[model samples]
Target: MVQGRIEKLRFIAEEMQIAFHLATNLTDPFFARTIARHILVRAENLIAHARGLRRPLRDAGFDTNAFHTAKEAYATEFEEYFKVARHKIGAHVQDFDFGKRIELWNDIEIVKLSYFVDGAREIYEGLAALTVPGYVPYAVPAELSDPKIVEILHQIQRSLDARTWVEMGTDSLAMARGNTSAVLNTTPVHARAGQLALIRRWIALQLELRGKLAAYPAIARLFKERIVTDIVSFCDCLVTRPVAADALQAMDGLNKLVQAENQSSAAIDDFVAASHFETDLAATRRVRDKIGAHLEIDEAETLPMLLADLNAFDLDKALAFYDRVAAAFNKQCFAVLFLRMYAADGARLYGVTMGHSAVKPFAGVAEPPPAAPPALPLINDEQEYAKNLRRWLDGDENQKGTARDFFWKAFMGSDSIEDIKETEHFGSGTRYHSHQFRKAHQFLLDALSDGLSDFDFKGVLDLVMSCRGGAPYPLSEVLVRCAPHAPVFRQYLICHVLGEIGSEPHESVSDFFDAQAHSPTWAVRLEAVMARYKSFIKNEGVFRTNHKGQTKVEHDALVASMTQAMSPDERLICLLGFASVHTGPLAGVFTTPFNSNYTALQAELEMLILPLLNDDDANSKVAMLKQLIQTHDYVGVSVHIAINLNSGENHPLYAALVDACCRGTIIAASNNQASRHLAISYVMKKDHRFAFEIAGPLADRNPDWIDAQILVAQILGEIVGAEADARKRVSSIRSAYKLSPMQEAALAAVETEVQNRVTRQEE
Candidate 1:
């Protein structure tokens, strides 16, 4: 009878445990409510059963001290609450009286219930406020309502069941099967191996899963559809076979350890009994045997069908199971290997623990330390290159070949001429051979004998161009070196190369130009003069600006470097280059148009160039104006010239210049040239009539040009009785374009000017 009562109590405890587990683990809110109700019912039942079992066990001559202790604790903590909960709320809900209910809101009507009053608290409070004579305000104790009550009941059941097991001789039977304290005759080496093997499998599974997860996105991006499909299939195969198989093998290894340890505990047994492991392992083996290990002809088991079968295997649950099992072994037996450590450290730890070297031995003596890389020769200076070349030519064939290989690798990054086309210094259209090296050698020998002549200059140029890879020696260094020795006519070729390459202009190149600028040959002198300005304009950072203005240090350094006295033509070229710096691509983006720094720089440059523009030489003035028209700076330079033209004398020249600047492209009126036109238009506002004449055509031709539209509208407002027309035109332009703050300011200025003009006329 006592045993039957104990069994009944155990059964109640197990039912409550199941309800509690379901309540916590199940995620559906509706199901959660159902499980919560079930847990309450089960908890009430367990309490009743435990209360009844105490007396029967005491009468059966069993020690009832633990039962008395549990009963006392229940009475002190949960007895009154459980009574009220069972009698008034849960089991006897029909017996409790509730006030007439009004339907305040329904779930469908309420968007969110949390926004309303706390229903449960209100119900309890209302119950407490009832005018019953002996009623005490009571809330269900947290302990009774909590799922943890089920755990307490389970512990009591376990204690009672353990005693019952002893009374029924089940403990002895388990002892007979295997003594818990018995030591194996030998260290369980095979069991340890199984443990390590399981760890290895786990590590492999983790690595495969992590690698595929990380690589799939990038692989999908970089590969074509067919290739991506194949790669995805490969990844799926890895996960389906190797990773899944590893999980299965890890389970088997864990089971082997349990068998080898010859000890059984509830935790380890619970892990072994988990049905998901068996289900998943069976599904995994089917995939491995049919699709992965062998491509079998089974229509019933397709790859997708087999893969879908694995959906039942929860990898997170499996990992938790393994961790639980390891913890159980650590507590019950000797310390087990830390599975996480093995998975994290990977094969390095495995090999070390297994007494194997981490590094695999090579088959032969390690390849002789790689031959030292060849150093680039110091040939930046022409004199240095000449000395090096003379020494190389004087050497025997082997030395000469070594020198050639060094130069070839330095210039082309490879000694073989087969890769010459691949070098950045060479173009696809140019075919080269090893013989070019020989020709270069002969040319250098000739040039060193008699300063480089026109005939041999081509060979030298080819060599210099081929070797211009921006290494220890670059095009700038080579040009500076070779400029002094290059023939007078070929100096222009060097200048052209320097300009084309766009490297930082070397000071020595400038000095060479200064010397050649006075050359007796007119063509040489002309080339030298132009090349000097070109080199200065192309120098790194010469024209680079931020939103502020030109980089002051670079601008100042460039100005200081202009030590050579300039002719009127040279000064014109400089002005053209400087003026265009602020008008390049996205001119307003890099430097604000007409910012103070830019205005100051312009004033400085105008002081130098305006006098030249007024030179008595008509041919020179015409030549300079034509040069400006042919370059990118034509609009900017012409605008500057037009704005600064003296009021009386050069008005015709200014008009002609503006006409030439605006001649070719109407699109320029709406684009980069718009800013320059806007500047000139603002200056011409002093003479509103002239401003209208200049800006009217542009505004009419490019109706979208906001600056021209604004200027024309402002000029019209300045004229008598055109106020309404100006207001209508300005409003239309403002509506059409999304004006920048500056453009908006210009529009605002136009309005202010129009208002002030009307005021002045009225006065």
Candidate 2:
């Protein structure tokens, strides 16, 4: 028979913990969607578990009053939080639709449903309030040191108030290093690596909070407000008379450092060249004022603002360049501080060099740059492009132009479409120009009507790269028409246009990748791999759905036209797509099989992929394994490794899987943990030492999971001889973990064994 109600509560707590880990740890939005759905399912299961516990607790309890009161309050509070989420968010109905409900208060509504920790905490609080024996379970430990970590973080902030910049920077760096000392002593390399990762996270936060903040308003604003005035004054002083000492320092620090090409004449020249400094300080100011510091301005507000101002690349480049400038300046300040610390004889050096007033900007500094020259166009090339575009748009001529001819002309006169789209105003030429590009888009599609036999594939790729804007098309019609063209060219169009194929009947992007990989040309095979990658990024490579269910007939026809051998890269990409699209454990009763119409195709692809696991090329195999790890495919990879193990094949693949497990590098969620445990069980019969390495990290992470704790205890007893220290470790687990009737009995059996071993050893 199953255990009592307390056991059920513990099981619910375990699920809640796993859900919280997956939701918080996995940061990628595409991967988080599946994790979020799993959390909601676990939350629903918790409600059922809570309800079942009430009847059992009342019948066995003498303290029913407190239990009853807490239950009623919790139920009332839960209904308020979960009313819309239970029906509208979790279900697809006519009036209360998931999409419509999400649009109302998107992040606020979704987070309440997805975050299980808060709900779990409320349940724990009520259980603690009850007075019945064993009814009030142990409080769950905070996820990796809650209040203590917060306290440590506050201490670090207090330390940041050091007098000088160097002192503050040194203190922050020391705290970052000191945080990882305990992780280094954990005894296992894998566990140490996982724990030490927090140091990098701490450093990244400091860089964002300390580094970026110091650079933005202080150094950036100063340069913007004073650079032109300082430079003009220095030039005027040089012509009319001699410069003052403060002016000389200002010119040496700001002007000479920025405009100097005499690399041998100064220390700053070498620093500037190595850092890739951009000389234009005025452009940097525009980006900061328009985008970073202000809120109300727009491209419409500043239409005559240079088109280059709107491109994100230009701003990003300018920001990066300014960061280097600030770092160089900050370094000079640190040097002065270091001199003052130890060199008593060099007090004069500090006094002369520490004149900060010269570098700092004043309120009166102001000037503007001279007017820029007008833009000129390639007249003949533009005329030809215009004629071809007009002809193709009007359907006036039977003569067709190549994508290369049209795209090359566009490139000479303009930047990438991304730059143009960002730079120009919607009311100005930007809107009209984007409309014209949409016409050019249709013209290119019409050019391919005759098929890709005469198409320069590279040229078409260049054109595809240039054609960017928010212009809608009938993508279903385009896909159907493009399907019969040359395999290479058709795959490129599919890769580029997959975003527009929403709810449209089309071939699976996977099928095209599998077919094109067999082509004689290497370029075609590379394009095929890239196309599958693009499709995976768009929506996990699932076939699109319509209101009338899947357009199954259209997809089947497209898959049936394939004939090619799969390259290694194609196999790797396809496996990644399959694993990402299919989640959950593979070992349980309700495991889902690969859902697809092409059974024979999938079987053939699997046959090709299995050999890769055993390849002699270590680099290639590791590369493939990295891709699997990145796509959250631990279960799928484990299943394949198990199949190979049964057949006594692929020794290298087995070694790789064991290394990954022992290193604790895989996603440490419930399904992934289950898969790793299963794999370790099979490996345990051969080598107990490797099994021990895997067991410690698993047990450490999942201290609340009774099964995991028991498993780790058993592994320790078998491999490490159940010494005094080992037995003590198991005893600690007994106290910390909430053991049920079954778990209590099982643990008692192990404890008896350990006691017998201790007596025999003493004798």
Candidate 3:
């Protein structure tokens, strides 16, 4: 279902992109008009399909916040506009009132008007000749003509394209493991051969490493310290210090190699000079020696000054130089050379056979000893096999699967389970008891709760799959047991399996959700919230029937009591559940006994939840923001935060809110919820420069977006007026007008303060 929705969205986005291009780029009015008619139709389809993705995506345990945010932004900005255009102009033209101004220009002379025109006379004359002024059949609104609409359409398409890529990559991995025959049939023979060869080399490398490590521990330590640790630190630096610090760290590491009091140091120095990193190295040394390592009284450099000096240094080139030096050091000192391989090329190389026949034998090299075969376990009887299985289930996480493999090998002995059962040495009537299987299942579940490696998790999932159609276990009980601190994937899989089992509504499931509703992991909390909503809808008839005898006052009292009993986090979850039902697939189909509308329910919940934002708990504040995002009340919540910022009450809560909002906005550039709030907060603090810096780029990027222009204009008015830069103030207002001419009225209201400043200056 999720895949179908994703594909539908992809199809709609692609169609929208094509329609948008045709509508915008076509010169012929006929073609433009024809394509323009379908523009809103395609946009409406995209919106519906995009919204349709949320339920299925949530069901699959994927985060849909970004998708949800983008869809809401698109819909909030364009849904009504498109609806009106589609109804009045695009499709239902007869419903439109073109008004009294639609008339024929019967007395106008086209050639004379063109001769009097200042420029582009031929084009003007051509247009005048083609113009049919009487009762214009279809007039596209200026709102639909703005280029920002199409640009946003393109962004939506790009977002879907990225999502589809992720889905396809995930599908490929699952398909390769679950259906080898399908993969084999689909993959090219040469590619398969390369894959096989690469696997052979990998196995050979593992064997070689094991043999070498056992034979010589000293060399392995050298490899670990010199090669592995160095490379790991280098990679860590890349992630932890992506900007100036990365360049500084790379220089520091190179300096150690250069300053060593040995012959190799001289060689490394010469290599650095040869690589043209000498100047960068020298500058780094000066900064470190003069400012960092020792604070000389004569040195007047600050940290920012040092950073500025290193700003011109090419970190990429420096990193590359370091790589070359490391490789040379390895080859010279250890007689080994490293080579880089692209991932695709490496995967392809797996198919090649690593045999003497496949490669020419090297001269003057002795044949190495053959790798020893793996040891097998001694399982003399069923008791021993059972003991080994138990041991495997209780074994070290790192050594997982060892005893299981041994037990399975010894017990099966090239025979099926049925075959072994029939030949069971005078045990013809043997039968397994449910308690024994249940006990073993309990052991597996316990092992999972303790946490397993990915390999062990996969094995456990396989075992769970084998028991699917039999008597259903207390899987919800297991979920409750593991919900507190299990791995996220484990929690998700447990939830997935519970859904698959279709277990009856049980106390254990509800308990699991109630406990997990406040889980630290957002994904787990989201799953719990969604599950609660689904459970509510699934039992809607039962709930309604049970409450039929109660009056509205009694129902409201009962709901209030239940809500009062919940903690802040639980109330937030309850609020999210209400939102899901309100916006969900079955929205409007189900109603409360108290006859509360979605808006009232939402507002009531907000009244309960919003107060907790000032409760001196950062977690509570952050959870509120996340719920706001889910409820499509993020912007409003941010505005509330901005209002509070004016009061200057809670510093920690303000910081936490801003941080969460910033992270939320990372999902898409179009999501300026954080920036808008932050700018407002800064403006209230009287830091107009900071406000302008925060809101200016949003206005530039979304020039035609009225809200962004208004925000920037407000910030700029304060900033420019404070400085009393009259010319700059006038330019700012004019630029806003030029960028969003259709939004002149809105800009006028925002720019009124700037106009007042200009008027005072003129006086």
- Candidate 2 least-lDDT 10 residues: 346-355
Deviating ranges (above 4 Å) for candidate 1: 1-469, 472-474, 480-485, 499-511, 520-564, 578-763
Count of backbone collisions within predicted model 3: 11
TM-score of 2: 0.24
Better of 2 and 3 by lDDT: 3
Ranking by TM-score: 3, 2, 1
Clashes of each: 0, 0, 11
Residue pair clashes in candidate 2 = none
When sorted by lDDT, best at the front, the candidate numbers are: 3, 1, 2
Residue-level lDDT for 744 in candidate 2: 70
Worst 10 residues of 3 by lDDT: 164-173
User: Which candidate leads the pack in TM-score?
Assistant: 3
What does candidate 3's lDDT look like per residue over 1-763, in tens digits?
5444343343334333344443334322222333343444445555665666567567756666656675676666454344565433332221122221011111111221122121111211222232322212222233345575455445543442332101111111112211111122122222222222222222233233324343333222212222222222322211122247545332223224223323233333333333333443443345333322222222144323533544444333333334443433322222111111211222212112222111111122234533753244454444554565455556653233445444334323422222111111112453332211233344445666655686766565544444444433343444456555766666655654553343344556666667665768654554555555445543452346576633322333434544565555454544544443443333343444323545566566566545545544556565655566554454336445544443454544444334333322211122455457656656655677877877876554333334665666566667654534433434444532333455566555555776677778899
Lowest summed lDDT across 10 adjacent residues in model 1 is found at 100-109
What lDDT would candidate 2 get against the real structure? 0.39
